[model samples]
Target chain A: MSPPESAPSIQDKLILLVEDNPDDETLTLRALSKNGIRHRIEVVRDGVEALDFLFARGAHATRVGWGMPTVTLLDLKLPRVNGLEVLRQIRADARTRNLPVVVLTSSREDEDLIQSYGLGANSYIRKPVDFVQFMDAVRQVGNYWLILNEEPPGHVP
Target chain B: MSASLIVPLALSASLVVAGLSWWNVVLHRRLRAGRDREEARCSAGPSPEEEQWRRAALEAAGQADQLRLQLRETQRELASLSYSISHDMRAPLRGIDGFSQALAEDYGDCLDATAHDYLRRVRAGATQLNLLIEDLLSLSRIVRAPYRPEEVDLSALVAAAAGELSAAEPMRQLHWDVQSGVAALGDRALLDVALRHLLVNAWKFTAGRIAARISFRVLETPGPEWPPGVPVYEVRDNGVGFDMQYAGKLFGAFQKMHVPEDFPGGRGIGLATVQRIVARHGGSVRADATPQEGAAFTFSLTSAPAGGEPPGAEVALPAGRMPVPGPGMTVPRHPTNAR
Candidate 1:
């Protein structure tokens, strides 16, 4: 666990990206930047880090300046923990249950897609192989979560 | 008077002998008639027990066919599962692609000639991965696409394919030989995809020729497994054909007989798609090609029975029932409670 005092600053309307791979994290950020999304973005490299950030524990214990992010772009496959397990925990907790979780994974499997929806995923998008298309999909997520969609009471500080 | 008495005794002896011979003939005839009646009763077709056995054997064969169909369904489900697994493989590939592109774009001048070459190789690998991912996705989609049977004018289908090809290269001169009113019973969209793949193959392989001819017509002969008069459509082209030895690999995904330089298009997914669509409609495909001469692709089609769900139809989840907190949330199955 990271030191509790050095909590990363939390801000409203932040997009929390839960991705284990650094390459995907960078690509996702690049895609968001290309789409003109400038809202504060947080990157957690694994499922455990994501849980720590959302629940305000471990290194993020003092992250009380802002509420939870407007949306979480989660990848299903992760190291330390799986994305599905993270989502299950999020839905189980009272504070982050209503948070919008957009599962942006590279999985095109019907089981994963349907099960994500069944488990209360706000939107499910399979990452496109083409960077240009991936950029467009990321743009839509930004638009929907940051601009169009209304914030849940828990997410708004 | 004594001589007359002797003549009368001789006549009486001759009449008794004749009567005995006639009775022997009548008894023999009655015995023969009774034997013929018994033989006819024994040889009157099969017995009732044998008839029952024959019926049971036929019923068993029918059940076996049904079981085969169920097996096919299970295979399709397995394919869906595998496709889901492949989805996870794309993540690292994208990371490799994305970071390499970023490195090239953001820090190009910092690297020398050797580094640039390495970066270029990395980009090339990423591009290849992208192409593979696209093919994989489309192939999965072809396996799962909806199918609805209707009368498809194959002439129109070929024409549409040719129209697109010609549209792509308007200046090129090509001749088309399409049979009129050639129709089949299948999903029209799927037939269109199959025809496009075949036609595109023809157009691609014939790129070296000055003037090439492509034909679309129905084969008079049926496939080996199909009954007589079952329609088999052929797409023949005068192109740089492949050897007969490699024909077996034609319908396999990612199977290539020619280099990208020689064929110049596609990643070997066209024929696989054609095969899948044709099979879903209860048909088969066969190819005959001669190296540096020509090739002919024949595909047959038969509509599926009514009320049969298409592949991947079972995977559709009811969207409305996923209960969120605000609205449209109905069924509340706790996903995490494994106990």
Candidate 2:
């Protein structure tokens, strides 16, 4: 099926997308383009890479003078470090503790929601099955977290 | 003449004693013969056929013992596996949910709404996985926890439960009628879980009603055959009740009277958990309801002694008195309202 229609006027914001699937990553990028949110997007395959990107550790260590992203969109399932552990780590560290974290997943379980909130997730939303609906959710999340909500200054690594 | 009579009496007595001794001897001989026969049969030693029978019996006993051990081991293994699966599966699901959330926050605007939605779906799916794990853990806990029975104030528990419910759904116009002074002997925790499930069910079912009326009270009936007084706790609610035909399966795991889509949420394990908790506490639960009118759940604690007289017949609450509230439905007086 053809992708949804594009939105006018792309917003300029830096975003780091942590996703394992290449197709999903591409779809996410395409959706963002359609929404006119043409911010610089950095993609990571898993939680470990996402952490490295956030902390400027491992391979990202060479990239000096990098600042924390405005928000962290976390997926619960990951290859190395799981989302909850990542959140715990983020919350534990004073530098990234106040960083806005949202949990996006397909799970409708109460425990997951409770845990997300318990671990200090800013918001939790379930992904829609339909492609168009999915796009709407993405747009709303982007509009709400990026343009609407005010976030703290970047954490220095 | 006297000496002759005495001599005859003594001879007769001797004769009688001799006869008795002779009979006793004969009886001893017969007993010895019977004992010999039994001993001979026992000591004859097993023939080939007898030996085979004896060996088969021993083997059957050994096999039975082995089977019993294997069954026990299997049960233990199953319990452990379920526990591990519930515990270990959460970490990965958390990772999926967390990272997707992170992705949305950081790059949501860069991506179109569709991509953001997909990520949200992934996160929701992970969250559902986590809930399934939790439900399994709850079921396991109900089975594994030790049960200790004690006197539980049903009135106080019911009042507290009602207060909590009111606090939760303050918007709803709820009428709670909980009797006072109801008490029973049961495991407090298990009973609490069961009662909570019932109250929660009541709350959910009555959601559509403009005015919800929930009652926690004890119904005293004559015990069958044994005693006059039997106390049964009843939790009644004016809500959307279920069909009578499906009532038998209401307590089965994952059994739902309504579709998941309609309910929007729930693992359908609440009633099953309640049933398990009740069974563990040696109690019985049954639901009675019509489609739209309401539902009443009644359960009895097995550990309670049968009342000697009809409830309220013997206790005689003072003039104009009434029975106490059921467990977990009490309403605490507001601090300012205290006398």
Candidate 3:
């Protein structure tokens, strides 16, 4: 069971953040950094970009020599392919079936909550309007998924 | 050829006969109206009674159509307004609050005390607007969300609200008297919201009392508006009550009677939401109070009445004397008290 020669080491934990709003993206990054998490976070602007990055298709076709992300912070409302649809495709594929996905969005609608869980989201956190609470929520999410949660074995495709 | 075929044939034949009879009644009414028209033509003009009936029917139909159109328009506007509030307005508010916070934390030493105070005010204003937006959304949700009626153990709802209120402020010495076995036929979640608001209102107003008292009990005697045997729930508290002259303004949104210095928190949307929920259940709510005495809110959820209880169940019990219904008492009796 030797490691693949071209694959990045397991010590390099990556976070895939799929968010559309730039302000929310900056705040989230700041929150994670404030919590002392130094993991390399890859930001995708929209649902379409998120899919390309995750599936290594379209603009990300030449993406190589990297392991699957440890966790994906997905936002629900997006431009082309919404977060729910992206999540569906991720679960549909065998390569990223067990990738831990946490749905972080501004929607507190019951339908969104139910549908996200129905589509196999690992966690759901509503973006609080209060900045302090938002920071706290992000802190908890980062602490749990990055440091506490045991990751599934990486599937290199 | 079998008995099943014969039974279905008989049932269908009976249904056809019933439908035909109903049509015959309709035909008879039409024929009578035509005959009356002919008689009017042969004589002078249409009778006053017939003219009045026709006008009333036309007016009712027109009013109904107008109301339906208005309702549709309101719903459309509400959907758009809720979207803008949740999606459009909240993002900017977040930015304001978040950037202000960042500036305060990262560059506090560069700013003077007055500048720090100004930033604090900006954050506070954003936070206040956020709460108002949330409350507005909640009020809209209560109006738009589907109504699901079922047997709700009101006693349990009150006690749970009381528990939460007490847990939040454990230092307060408040006496609770929640009547057990008080039930209602309504949406459980909506009923919980209404009950919590009422309980919270009582809890907030009764803060200054050394021994604050909050009680929830059902009136045994039915009011004039309620049908016989329908229970009217009352949430009473011993606190500083508002003047009855201003009671009309109490349930309106953003109508605060008490000063913020006296009773902090609450955007004054709770009672309006409570009123909306009760109206949805084909019920009504009213408030009664004296300046120094406490306030009492009585409401009736009479759309569908719960099963008939032993008449004496509404008897007021001593404080903290609740009979906690056990798991064995799980089967809640559905509404059977048909008026």
| Local distance difference test values of all predictions, in order | 0.68, 0.63, 0.74
Cα distance off (Å), candidate 2, residue B174: 1.6
Least well predicted 10-residue stretch by lDDT in candidate 3 chain B: B330-339
**Residue B117's C-alpha lDDT in candidate 3?**
99
DockQ of each: 0.47, 0.03, 0.61
Q: Which stretches of candidate 3 lie over 4 Å from their true place?
A: A1-11, B1-84, B163-181, B210-212, B220-231, B303-339
Candidate 1 C-alpha lDDT tens digits along B166-279 = 899988788989898997766788888889999999998888677788999988765565545556789999998899988887887777888887666678878877877676
lDDT (10s digit) by residue, model 3, range B96-156: 9999999999999999999999999999999998888787777766765565667789999
Winning candidate number (lDDT): 3
> Which scores greater on TM-score, model 2 or model 3?
3
Candidate 2 regions with alpha-carbon error over 4 angstroms = A1-157, B1-75, B102-110, B222-230, B259-264, B303-339
| Residue clash pairs of candidate 3 | none
Give per-residue lDDT, candidate 2, residue A140. Answer: 86
Locate the minimum summed-lDDT window of 10 residues in model 1 chain B: B330-339
Query: Interface RMSD (Å) of model 3?
Result: 1.3
